[model samples]
Target chain A: MKVQISGLCKKYDGKPVLNIDNLTFEQGRIHVIIGPNGSGKSTLVNIISGLEKADHGTVAYGSNQKRFEEVRGSITLVMQHPYLFNTTVFSNIAYGLRCRGADKKQTELLVKEAAEKVNLSAFLTRKAATLSGGEMQRVALARALVLKPELLLLDEATANLDPESIGIIERVIRDFQTATGATVVFITHNIFQARRIAERVYLMMGGRIIEEGSKEKTFGNPESRITREFLRGELIF
Target chain B: MDNITNGFFGALELILSGNREVYGIIGLSLVVSFVSVIISMFFSVPLGIVIGMNRFPFRKAVIMIINTLMGLPPVIAGLVVYLLLSRSGPLGYLRMLHTPQAMVIAQVLLVSPIIIGVTLAGVKDRGNLIQKTAFTLGANRCQALWTIIKECRTSIGASLVAGYGRAISEVGAVMLVGGNIKGHTRVMTTAIVLETNMGNFDQAIAIGIVLLVLFFILNILLQKYQGA
Candidate 1:
């Protein structure tokens, strides 16, 4: 679903973490939000997913412009650190479906499909906590994907993954977006990765979106001087 | 040595022969403690999850209060329950004082804070990830809390075991409120107390043996549940 956020502000201990004036994400597009470390990219996506509340803001989702609670089940977020429930991979994948009271046959089928997508089918019976970092992340992705959320928010999901693992996750996510026409909000520090994955891009700094445009204009010929300096790695944000 | 051996045999015989008094005491003790723990769990588990996972004003102070209550002396707990149920007290019209129900209420008062305190400690280490994830994945508040409780099942189970230990071994509170009346509120602990006071050491030792055996069986069941 299309998401528009306006006047968003969040603070931690009186220090503002996110302060966005207005940002719009088109439905069925891959939107990458790039920022330096601690640039509030996660906070922005978290606010969209209602994982974190904005001190002052309005989040409009879809054509209806409904609140977060109204469109609650259609959004999902995967954090930087992999959070797999300390259970078998199968149960972790099935937890969402179970919580929503899905039937046995459907839950099994969806979990199986999701596992196949993330290539975690073989490890379904394995304890989730025993998996390696990359494997655990894959399990988390599978768990979220099984829910078939309309808006998937991934915050630095591939930050620490090996290139091979990153490639696998990216491939599955791209396939998912193409197949379901879901909105994918990806936050990353790598501009090249953004250029590779994003149809539209927003660059944030100091709790605000300093630059935003298509991939070519923002990454190749940005208007903002800070964006230019940030691209050149000459300025520390 | 003679008294010890004789007492041991007497205890064994009393248990083996299935005396009604011994059985009744065992049964009542189990019922009262179980009811109390169940009651405590219903309130404390949810309260603990809410407090441990949410940020609110004076949250630390509330946690401090719960922690302090976990260490509340048993007699003090009994005194509170006693006053609430006594004939001259506000709830005196209920006429529940000295009944098995009163014992359950007293034990619940003594152990609910322990349950909430330990559960809070357990959930405090979980760091809100489960609740956030669950909510994002289409879970309501109840479902999210259930997710947290399930994730920390081991810790919650340990908290329950601790509460049970406290409830079963209690004496001062139950005696004060339950009145330790013969054949009615006389549980294992109170039976042992009465037997000892009347200089019936053999019978007291017998009840003590029964209590130990009861503990072993119950703990085994608990371990099985935890393992499952």
Candidate 2:
């Protein structure tokens, strides 16, 4: 889905946190949003996913420009610190399908496929609480992926994951996009990771998008000075 | 020593002989308390989930009221119910006093706040995280709230046990509203009290033993149901 945000603003305790005049995410692309810790990336995604309300602005999705409520079932978000339900991994992964009223046979098939994609088929019967951090993250990913969302939002999903886990996640993201033509918005702090996976890059600072372009243009020849400093690791944020 | 021995033997004899009156009292106690807990659940579970999961005007005030009522005295609850069901009172036309239904009503008044308070505490502890996770996974508001209730099942089960413990073990409210009529409103606790006051120590101790054993057995059943 192509998502557009216009005149967006958010505040916490009367202190402005995010302000975006206009931003567009093209359909079927990996759009990486890179920013430092307090840059409102998470907040923006929360509003986009309709988990939170923006103080001002409109976030519209798809060709019809449907609001978040109208298209909520087609959007899914994986959080930075994902909460796996206190049950078997199979149940957690099958939760979304159950919510959508998928039948038992179809849910079982899709959950297995999702677990296989994330290399978690062996852990399906195990309790979710017993998994290590990386395993838990994979469970979260499988849980989201089984739903086949049109818009997938990852908020620092692989921040502290091991290289093997990261590789599996990146491969899953790539494969999912190729297979479904879905829009994937990845939020991260590591610039090189962005370079590796982002087809389009959005650099945000202090609640605003400082620069955005294709990966090569933004990384090699940026228009904004702050973007250059950010790329060079000299900016303090 | 002799009374204790006699009471122990009397309890065994009552069970083995299938004493109808003793069995009836036990049955009535279980029925009244279980029905009260079920009625309390119908109100407390949904209200607790809603109040615990959302922020609205006077939420703090409402929670404070429920917490205060969690410690509400059973005698006070009985007195209120008694007055309300009296002929001159507002609900006199229901004609529900001195009956099992009256006992159930009084116990409901005593137990609802406890379930509500514990539920609120449980929801406040982990409800937000569960609700947010459910929402991000494409659950609607009702679905998300239901997920929170399910995920917090441990605490909710604790609340149920607590409410049942209070209802089954209590003597004040039931005695006041039930009137301890023979073959009618007489429950185990009231039977024990009447026997003790009338110097029938063996019978009182036998009834007390039955009460503890019944509670233990029911507790195990409830836990099993919760696990399932």
Candidate 3:
């Protein structure tokens, strides 16, 4: 889905956090939103996914620009510290399908497929609570992937993950978009990861989009001074 | 020492021999307590989930009131129910006073707050996360709530057990409202009180033993359910 934001404004305790005038993430591409800690990347994705209401803004979805409620089920977000339900990994991965009332046979098929994609088929019967952090994250991702969301939002989804898990997640994300033709908004703190996966890059600072373009243009060519400094690792905070 | 020895043997005999009157008291106690706890669970569990999972006006006040009521004396709850059901009182038209129904009402009032408080405490920490997680996964409001209940089922079970304990061991409210009529509304606790008052120490000890054993068995069952 093509997501468009306009006149967006948000505040925390009367202190402005996000104030984006206009931003659009094109459909069927990996758009990496990179920013430092507390830059409101998560907040933006939360608003886009309908998990949070923006203080003053609008988020419209798809070609017809439907409201959030109309497109809610098609959007899914994987959080930074994903919460796996206290149950078997199979149940965790099957949760979204069950919510959509998928029959037992179909749910099992899809859940197994998603788990295999994330290399978690062996862990399906194990308790979710017993998994390591990386395994838990893969389970969370598998669960979201099974739903076949049109708009997939990952808010630092691979944060604190091991190298192997990160490689697996990035590959799975790339594969997911390619196979499903879905829009993937990947929020990350690591610029290198953005360079590796982002077809389009949006650099945010203090809740505002400082610069955005194709990865080659945004990273290699000229852009905002702040973006340059951020790329060079000199833009502290 | 002799009296204590006799009471122990007499209590075992009373239970094993299945004295009709003693069994009647035990049956009545279970019936009243089970009814009250079941009724209270229907109200308390949902209310607790709602309060624990949301933020609204006077939320702290509502929690404070529930907490206070959790510690509310059984006599006070009985007095309130008695006034409500008495002939001159508001609900007197139903003519439920001095009966098992009245005793059930009183126990419901006494037990509800305990269940609610415990359930609230159980769900408070993880309820929000569970609800939000389910919602993000495409669950409707009811579905999300069902997830919260499932996640916190252990705490909910503990609450039911706590409420059951309060209702079964309760004496003041049942005594005041049930009138302890022999073979009618009399339950184990009230019978024990009556027997002790009449200096039938052996009989009182027997009833006490029955109450303890019954509660212990029920507690084991509840614990097993929680573990499962």
Candidate 4:
């Protein structure tokens, strides 16, 4: 449940996006990464989750220091814009289970449990295509949660949600973290969301982790000007 | 002008009365077109998906060939089939010339490329998102393919309808291969041709009306299937 990333760098079309030296996420903790758009927060998450390859770096997991292929099954990523299958909500949540060869009974139970966890049990039979943006994000969360991965990655997972839905999602996420004690890495541009969810904060700027500490220190007493400006909502690129 | 009106109404009356000749032509046309469409679906849909989803050497060349075949003249296809199945030809031993089976074979060849080309375009356009999402969900190759197929079901339906329309309306290939044999291979298109040449405008128009209605019905079904 521990991940250590070092010397991670990525480039697209010869332009560098993410260039990180070292960072670590402890088990049973919520880590939030905050930055402006195009600051490479998403790129870092993508590289860690095995969604994209790093040009140079090593992402080691646990005491044995396993690589991505060895630890991929233990990590799940929910992208910024959740992609739902053109099927019922029940099927969408049950997809991960089905992929892992869960039987019909197990699949139904897990889907229902995950739906209830996310407060979406009432909409299980509805067509996924007809759901609102917030509902879709909940479905995505339910899908990831049902897998019970060791590390969960969220990329602006609640950005499109209404306040009510956002609150519900936040509570569900907090409860899941408390109950399962899994590591969570969340990315957001919303400063308040980071403040609300994260125990530890990593302030990223220009693809590097500029500041890292407890959420109270990073948000309350910033050391970097970039961090100061970002917290005050003055940083604009 | 008077003849046209009489022919149209007479055809409608024949349809209502269940005239055996009209029924025979209609039934034969349906069988030929349906069989051709089934065969085309079997080959073309998978071919289209594979071409759309994977890349290989000469993939573009293969696609270009299929696209070229989509616009192939029906008469040219007929001529080719006629040559292959004619007596003393390579496949002449099967004695399939002037039979409904020969017509089905010709129509299958004529319409398969159309189905493949159109379905390829549809599959390629929608494949990326489905692939990305399915892979992220840990779907292996086969599962990813099934997901893409499910997502592109509407496009597949459209391709099938287009193939059916082309197969049923085509007179040249069916006429050449089937030879308009009465009660055996006399499909609507061929019957219409034969009746018109024999100065029987009423029967020709009757078959033509049936063809038009069949096309309309197929299109309606396709629309409903896609909308669903």
Candidate 5:
């Protein structure tokens, strides 16, 4: 699904944290937003996924121009330090289906499918509270992926994962992208990861999108000075 | 020494023989406290959750009020209920004075604040994460509340158990409102009081034993639910 934002502004404690004049995110491609710490990348994604509100302007989703509440179920965001419900992994994965009133058979089938996709089939019956850190992140991924959200937002969801876990998650994410072809908004500080996964790139510094373009043009052949410095790891905010 | 020994043995006998008076008191105590806690929860649990989850004007003041009421003297509560149900009081026309209904009212008044206070603490401690998680997973407001309730089930159960303990072991409020009417309003705690006042220490000890057993079972159930 396509989303367009214009004249968006968000402030905290009477100071502007995000002040985007205009931005558009298109459908069916993995988009990566890269920035330094406190550069409002997470804030922007949160605004997109309707987790946090923008003080000014609007976020128009898809062709219908649906507001957040109207299409909230179709958008899923798995944040950094993801929280799993104090329940079995299977139940956690099935939660979205259950909330939508899916039947027992459908819930079981879909939950198992999602669990297998994340390679968590063996942990379905285990209590979510007992899982390790990386396993918890996988459960969170399974939970979000099970719903097959039309717009999936990942806000540094794998920031501290082990390399092996990160590799697994990246593979699963690739598999999902190929299968559903849904719009994926990825936020990360890892330039290597951005290079590997980004189909398009947006660079933000000081709460503004200084430059945005396709991956090759944005990262490989940088245009803006800030973008070039960021690519060289010298643009520390 | 002989009196205490005899009282213990007599209590065992009364319990083993299922003495009707003792059993009736035990039954009435359980019924009144159980019903009162159940009704109180319908109002208190939600109140606690709302107060805990949201930020509003005077929230700290409301929390202070609940905390103060948690330590409300049972006698003051009993006196207040007595005035309300007495002949010259506002609710006197209901003619519920000296009845089990009045006892239930007093117990509810005493128990609700305790439940609300404990439950509020539980919600404040762990409500937000589960709620945010549920919302991101596509749960609506009602569903989010249900998920928070499920996540905090252990603390909620403990809160209810605390209320139960306070209600069943209470003496002043139930005694004042119930007027200690035999075979009708007499509960375990009130009966213990009346029997001891009349120098019938054996039956008092016996009833106390039964009360202990009931408390033990209830706490066991609470612990199991908490651990689950």
Candidate 6:
């Protein structure tokens, strides 16, 4: 489903955190958002996923037809911090499906499938709280994926992973997107990883979208000085 | 010095011999404190979770009131319950005065706020992470609530210990309400009071020893749980 965010805005303590005029996410595409620290990338993901309410404007899905709450089950967000339940890995992946009342057999099938997708099948009985950072993120990812959401929102999903873990996560995400045709909105400060994964890129600065375009144009020949400085790892503001 | 030494050894012997009175006090104290803690849990866990997780009008006021109530004097709780159950009082028709039921009521009144207050603090401390994760996982309000409570299980365990500790050691409320009746409403604290007053120093020391041991064991459990 297409996601159209129009005039999305949020403020904390009277200071603006996110202000996007208009942005459209195409179905079945990987959209990456890149910016420096404190660029409101996570805030955007939170607003889009309904975890935080936008102060003004609206986020609609499917050709501006459905509001976020109207299409609630279709979007899933994997937060930057791996929020694991104090339970086994199997239960962590099965949590969302169980909340939706999935039967035992179906839950078992989905749990195994998600774990195998993330190569966590061997750790099903392990406590989620005991996993490493990368494993925790994978469990979070598996949880979101098992819901089969149409729109997957990721806030720095691979931010703290080691190189090997990052490669494994990228492979899993690619396979899941290929099989399910799920649209992905991933936020990261890593330009190199963005280049590797994103079909379209959005540059955010000072709580606003400064520039957006296809990866080649935005990365190779950016329009804004902020974008250029960000690519160069130089101070922008 | 002689009285202290004899009382101490006699108390130990009484416990070792499984003296009927000692067993009676132990059993009564356990039953009363356990019942009170169970009732406190039933009421306070849900109240704590609600107050910790939701935002509504007077939420802060309600929390403040509960916290204040946690520091309420045990004697005052006894007086309040006493007034409620006394003859010609509002609940006098039930005629529950000078009974174990009345003592349980006073203990519940004394400890429910403690349970609620401690559980509230625990829930507040852990509510943020659990609520955020649960909401992101598409959990509805009730599911999110249960998730928060489950996450604070260790804290809830601590609250139970604290409540039971307070209820079991309480002497004022049980003495006033249970009336220290021998073999009927008598608990350890009340029995010790009667024994001490009647110059039965051996029995008083025995009960005191038992109370000290119980408190020590509870403290050890609390420390272990906190470490865990």
In candidate 4, which residue ranges exceed 4 Å CA deviation?
A: A4-9, A21-23, A54-72, A220-225, A233-237, B9-21, B47-70, B79-102, B117-126, B177-184
Fraction of native contacts (fnat) of each candidate: 0.78, 0.78, 0.69, 0.28, 0.75, 0.69
Superposed by TM-score, candidate 4 places the C-alpha of residue B55 at a distance from the truth, in angstroms, of 7.5
- Kindly report, for each predicted structure in the order presented, the TM-score of its chain A compared with the true chain A: 0.96, 0.98, 0.98, 0.97, 0.97, 0.96
lDDT of 4 at B123: 85
Q: Can you tell me the DockQ of model 4? A: 0.39
What would the per-residue lDDT of candidate 6 be over residues A1-237, giving only the tens digit for each residue?
788889988999899998889989999988999888888988988888887899998888876579877778778888888679889999999999998899999999999999998889999999998899989999999999999988898899898788877888888878778888889998887888889988899999888999899999998999999888878875322
Alpha-carbon runs more than 4 Å astray in model 3: A234-237, B218-228
lDDT of 5 by residue, B76-157 (tens): 9999999999999999999999999999999999999999988889889678777878888899999999998888887788
Residue A33 error, candidate 3, Å: 1.3
- Per-prediction DockQ comes to 0.66, 0.73, 0.75, 0.39, 0.71, 0.70
Each model's iRMS: 1.2, 0.8, 0.8, 1.6, 0.9, 1.0
Name the 10 consecutive residues with the lowest summed lDDT in model 6 chain A.
Answer: A228-237
Quick one: best TM-score, which candidate? 3
**Docking model 5 quality class:** medium
User: For residues A82-103, what per-residue lDDT tens digits would candidate 4 score against the true structure?
Assistant: 8798899999998878877999
> Against the hidden reference, what TM-scores do the models get?
0.93, 0.94, 0.96, 0.85, 0.94, 0.92
**Candidate 6 — what's its lDDT?**
0.88
Q: Give the per-residue Cα lDDT of candidate 2 at B119.
A: 86
lDDT score, candidate 3, position B61: 98
Better of 1 and 2 by TM-score: 2
The DockQ ranking, best first, is: 3, 2, 5, 6, 1, 4
Candidate 3, residues B3-23, lDDT tens digits: the string is 788888987888789889888
Candidate 6: regions farther than 4 A off: A235-237, B53-68
Report every candidate's CA lDDT. 0.87, 0.90, 0.91, 0.87, 0.89, 0.88
Candidate 2 wrong stretches, greater than 4 Å: A234-237, B215-228
lDDT of 2 by residue, A16-100 (tens): 8899999999999999999888899999999998888998899999999998888989999998889999899999999999999
Candidate 1: misplaced stretches above 4 Å?
A234-237, B214-228
